[model samples]
Target chain A: MNEDAVAGEKSLKGIAVYPGIVIGKAQLVDRSKVKIQYQYLVNTEHLNGEVGRFEEALRVVEKEIASLKNGMAEKVNDLSFILDSHLMILKDNMLRDSTIRAIRDEKINAEWALKKSLEKIRKVFEQIDDEYISNRISDVENVTERILRTLSGKAQQSLSEIDRRVIVVAHDLSPADTTELNLGRVMGFITDVGGRTSHTAIVAQALEIPAIVGLESATDVVADGDLLIVDGSTGVVVVNPDDRAIIYYQEKKLQLEDYRSSIARQSHLPALTPDGQRITVMANIEFLEEVTAVRNYGGEGIGLYRTEFLYLRSKGFPEEEDLFEDYREIAELMAPESVNIRTLDIGGDKFVSELEITKEMNPALGLRAIRFCLKRPEIFKTQLRAILRASVHGHIRLIFPMISGLQELLDAKDILEQVKMDLDRDHIPYNEKMEVGIMVEIPSAVVMAGVLARHVDFFSIGTNDLIQYSLAIDRVNEHVAHMYQPFDPALIRMIGRVVTAGRSEGIRVTLCGEMAGDPLCVPILLGLGLDALSMNARSMPLIKKIVRAMPMSQARDDLKEIMGLYTVHEVQQYLFERIGGMFPELREKGYL
Target chain B: MEMVRRLKIRNSLGLHARAAAKIVELADRYESELFLKKDGRQVDGSNILSILTLACPKGTDMEVRIIGEDSEQFMTELDALFQGKFGENK
Candidate 1:
């Protein structure tokens, strides 16, 4: 087998978690610890004063921990427990006692004493022979980072202090490091080393940050203040980009930024085609904080709320109250706006230890989402009960995920009925009239949409998974990720089948995956008769802008003409030439 | 000395809750006032509010603190929780 050769030169590439091009000089975020020996050498003449210095360092460490915890809690809900643990470690009496002893007995400095004790902790973790335990070494590293920064008297100036919008070039960044970056000022990231699942990469994706990692010598190649062009979607970073390329990119970036504002202005407006057809645009969110997107970004309501995130977090099942309160909060927030909650799409990549939902031989096709929920009827009922209970607070619609065929649909309905019976028997108040829907993810569901449509209130096509399952490809698999095409005629035909099926039965049809948010696929989805489009709030404005610019009849005709042709590349090119300037940001991001 | 209390993970996403609540729960079970630490930072376990601030991810090992009375027992149980994958279902 011929192995692909690694690029030896300095290069930068990472998944475009966030989209935007930023070019500026390299501002290295120094998270490294200071040398302990240097501290001892400086303080050798004043052994008595070293204690006071150590005490001051300890105080600074404690203060930083408190501030860090407080800051993190403001953005994310409950991660401070780890910070408390770190505070205790920084103040650990045993570690402190031993370090103090070492300082006097071995003539070692405070940093060395701490480092020496930390070595023992690493050893203990190493003996456990587990990655989870072993990774705690970072905790030590984090504390050291604080202590060293304090010692160096430069603890307060973090990555965020880089006051200009520029490409962030680093050797590698930790999750904490990535979180601290001022997203507005930071245009892109170029790291020397990191994989797709690295904390830096994951955070970048969630923030919609344009990043490129795993490029060796990226720091050296891109000097401080060098003009660089980062293509996050393609994991490409052009250092000192040519003048012509810079001019092209600068114009493209401006157009994209302008389009975003324009979209923001029209967020509240109905997505009306030139021919006067209206389509509902909804938002997809993973957390409660994102609820504001509905009003701020012009979403009718949440199209899909992946409930598995709730299940993955708890040690056991989320209490009925837990699910109830969560759903209720989301519903009440949206109030008049509709919220479609997708029941526990756990299993596969999403796992919960208490669920006892074992990984299968093929997790993608195995017991997951609706299949897993159906297997454990009691669990499904608990969720259904919570969703139905919350329905009274808002216009809530429930959707089931990964329905392969009609049987699964029937089984889900059966469970929903059982939940209704349990609630009725208990005289629990719930919205009995709330509509139910199914996610058309599997090819089997897409093919039998007509039959499946009859059982559900609506059809929200999950195009991300549908395309993956249809092509037998994983969008994350670098080698085959290219194979994961959104506009493939096969997928277009599949979506067409579901849309036609839903329309035939008077069922509302929507697309709630990344594809729906895509400008290229927007016109096609409209032409195929999709009732609504739901996606990230960020994409809502632009999608609405594009939809409003086109006539429904013209869009339909154009989609028909394009679909008749063959090849993914052709489909992309046609969309590029047709919808080019309307979605300049999408074009700048190289979605074309 | 060690004091131990059984606490179920209440936060969504178990140990990985935005504040690393499980780690905090383990640390709070002692008089020395345990801390579940990551990097060089310490999160007080007994402080529900404090622990919820750590943001440790799922399957992450949190540093446990056992300061005063019943420190030994709390340490043992906390160690077991980490060893047992925080009772994570397979």
Candidate 2:
């Protein structure tokens, strides 16, 4: 009744990663094809003034970037060289001369002239075949966008300028950008690119802001200030909705809101089945910013603290202190709660820090994770030292990623022991008995789980990589994505074995992957005897709601029944049918 | 005085932003008018973006020209930079 929806409506469907509904104004943050509201010629009288306006905007941007570079330069070095190139782009005479020429000779406004210069430069860049060099245009485009924003006095695209709540429309919101939207002005998200498991969806769900991802064209279609009805529950986004759609959704919003609050009230309670079996629900976070969201979602501890953001965000090698500051902050925030810090799992092809002369042939199988760390012990020790130092702050645990065999596991542990001795001799205090764990994601590791379990304190099954390696399918390749099945009986059998291995060794085992977050996969995971399930914090409540309803005694039997069926389709069907019968609410129109 | 030199881009990344910025920074010191030519296309050697548009990858052959009172001195240092691979070998 309160929110009004206009006419000329169009609806778009996408994978709804989070559940909620909101109607708000749209704010487009697509920096690629910047939208300019004005493009008019300047009068002869104001021609000089316009040129001066352009010059002043350039100066302001120069100072803005210069100060930013200086600020980051204090804590880190060498990375400034990356930001320094932006300064060069901003001050490049090619852009300056062409823009000023267009302003004076063509009699155009500064914004129009700047855009014209940008288009010309882009044209020149488009001819280049090198993907890396062609990609550098984004850097130049970013600088030009800043200049345009400054010229129009709208330089504050930092989202704080928005007074009213608006849904952000973007190409893709990275982990950093997702957390930065903690701004109260932003209500929801509609991104053109992202999967159901992206950090944006996880953050949106954890923050209770509904999100719809993989819309493919939301950024291009939604204009600034256009009325948007974002229904994350139904996985539908209605653009410029009419009156009937608004009234219908308004009531649906109220009912869903009531249902979510009821779930939230009991989310913090222990996740125990009627048969008295308990499971620990934890959050898998990559940045310090998500720690509060983890706790707010009733996550008991950090299940997987992915440390790749340090390398990814900087687009260069981050220093030890940079790693320490992030690890320390997350540890302090989640004090008394065990934070499992997984050492860097990023591949070298994506790594920008090393002066890569030639990219790897196949990075996923090439020098990555524990393999790369073993080769570059200095890079490895840098992270190990930081993690060890931060372990003094909270209940921190170290988990090595992609350990294919006992040799890699023992070799990585040898380096960790060496780092501890180095720290101890220097009188640096660390947890003398910091727990160590390995990701039981590799098929070999699963086969040798009994041998692998004896050496580590815990086993965290990384299903994302586990399914990929075991099934031998690239998870992102659309042609075989359906083949990358989570319910593949082989993987279920492997997880059952890993849990069995952990129990034999008297150590706890957890599942920390997308499967851990999936509602359809929860009962099977419970029946397999996993001690904990660490997933996107947003999925905790939904998973808990399912766990709270079913008794573990029945789930163990359900697992045994489904395990008898070998094919993915049969197992998936059996689980879905079981879930439907248990909670008929899940059968309501793509509710799963 | 005018001077010209032919050089090979020894750096593996070619004329990327950092490498081009190095050339631009070196050009800033000399009074010479500097220009770079590759495959019949010439660009202002001191403009980073202009130099980048050349898109010379590693092993590409290019020519450098300097015209001013500082031409010879600029040529000497430019040759050193070319041979040094813009200090990126590390």
Best by TM-score: 2
TM-score of each: 0.72, 0.77
**Candidate 1 residues A378-438, lDDT tens each?**
7888899999999899999999999988888888898788889988999988998899999
The global C-alpha lDDT for each of the candidates, from Candidate 1 onward, is 0.70, 0.81
Candidate 2 lDDT tens digits, A1-592: 3223322347777768777788987887776555565555647778888888889998999998787676662433444665678888877877998899998898888888888888898898999987677778888887898887777665454433346678988877765354334346678898876665555665676566888887878977887677888988767889988778778888888877777667677778878888788899999886677887788779999999988867765533677888888888888888888999999887732454342424777766788899888998988999999999999999999999999999999999999999999998999999989999999888999999999998999999999888878988764342455576789999999999999999989999999998998888977998999999999887788789899888988888999898899999999899888888887765653356
After superposing candidate 2, which stretches have Cα over 4 Å from the reference?
A1-9, A34-88, A102-136, A147-163, A171-185, A199-208, A219-225, A348-363, A472-484, A566-569, A584-591, B1-90
Off by over 4 Å in 1: A1-57, A72-77, A93-116, A129-160, A163-256, A308-322, A347-368, A371-382, A406-411, A581-592, B1-90
Q: What lDDT tens digits, residue by residue, belong to model 2 across residues B1-90?
A: 999889899976787777888898888898999999998999888788899999999998899989999899899999899899987652
lDDT of 1 at A511: 92
For each candidate in turn, the interface RMSD (Å) is: 8.1, 1.1
Q: Report, in order, each candidate's fnat.
A: 0.00, 0.63
Full-model lDDT, candidate 1: 0.70
Using DockQ as the measure, the top candidate is 2
